[model samples]
Target: MADEGRRDRCLAAHEAPPVPPEGPVTTRLPRRSFARSATEVAPELLGHILARRLPDGVVLRARIVETEAYDQNDPASHAYRGRTPRVRVMFGPPGHLYVYFTYGMHHCMNVVTGPVGTASAVLLRAAQPLEGMERMSIRRRTDRVRDLCRGPARLAQAFDVDRSLDGADLVRGSEIWIERGPGASAASIRRGPRVGIRVGTDLPWRFWIDGPWVSVSRPAAVLSPR
Candidate 1:
């Protein structure tokens, strides 16, 4: 049976399927199509979950609450209009991960969306912990459930996500992927303009969980994507 399990995993890897966590990792939740191009994914990703399995058998999951979009031509985007050693992954075949550092302090994770060659991505904004609470609490240095996966960079640290995850194939990596959640209750998904950008503050691309301490920052403006 052990050998069979190994063989099964090898075959699954050969097929490039996501590495399921030990003991029934499938959340058995709703899955969505990558229908919105990357341009729209920025705000769309705000209510999703970003999950990763640790080597110690704990899986960390965060509910996305906030996100900012990046377009190739958008000066606010790192790549702007040209490719750099860092932003190349953003020019993707889709379903890939794009990680970068900000303020020299925190790492941010984004999902590449849209057709290849167009650098578009949805920034993960927030997540509510659905599994592995003990693990998340430890990483966050607090037992406060609300503080564990509250913000973009905090979510990354809570999962130990770093540059190593920069180009990881999100749809298939053992260490990273996004799973659909029950989602913030309909009344719980709060929409608003983005934070931290010097310009394009009117894009209304940020999303967050309403009425929960899980949100590290509130949308300065209350409105969904246009």
Candidate 2:
């Protein structure tokens, strides 16, 4: 497995720096595309590109591989307590970035979804690195392509995402925006309990491609049990 190989490499060269990617900027996903419920948006996000372009013209790109849905009424969501200073953007319209700092150490990003006044979003989990990986390596301090964005916090670091991007318009062609890229069919997507939480963990809102590399291991029960 790729992960096993990664373990071996890490044991051998855990301190080695990663090689960055070199490429042109890829297109961004349209703004209108995010006008859907968080549940409808999560699984569909797989294989799409989430990109960040620097002022120097270096474009960092990653293919979204995993996500988790957070609804207004979900007990596990930040907005479950109603809107506040930190979660205000999540209550806004769709297609905007809802970034937040977590653990006092790293940032995580989510795409605001659902109708206006609805506090729902899809947490971007893992992504497959595509462009400008050299810089990503510098930010993440690792050379493993799979390790670049194998988790949400790591994804933020790999793409230079942080609280400053909070409420940024994703559909507005800005420094950070999502662009249409490869996507999987519904059957190719899987769902399981959300990670790192006790409340609402059994909701099965987490979604990911079945075979692609992922940050988390597959849960024991696959939703719908194909």
TM-score of 1: 0.78
Give lDDT tens digits, candidate 1, residues 32-124.
Answer: 334357555554555566778775657776666666676777767787858888898888667777888888788888888777788877777
- Over 4 Å off, model 2: 1-27, 220-226
| Residue 210 displacement in candidate 2 (angstroms) | 3.2
User: Pairs clashing in candidate 1?
Assistant: 62-127, 63-126, 63-127, 63-128, 64-126, 65-126, 65-207, 66-125
Worst 10 residues of 1 by lDDT: 27-36
- lDDT over C-alpha atoms for residue 152 of model 2: 92
Model 2 is weakest, by summed lDDT over 10 consecutive residues, at: 13-22
Off by over 4 Å in 1: 1-18, 22-32, 184-188, 214-226
Cα lDDT of all candidates, in order? 0.66, 0.79
RMSD of each: 6.1, 10.4
On residues 1-226, what C-alpha lDDT tens digit does candidate 2 reach at each position? 1255544542343233322223332355555567788988888788898888754668888889899999989999999999899999999989888988888798999999988899999999999888889999998999888899999999998887766667777765446777788787776677898898879977889999854458888664443522
In order of appearance, the predictions have TM-scores of 0.78, 0.84
Cα-lDDT of candidate 2: 0.79
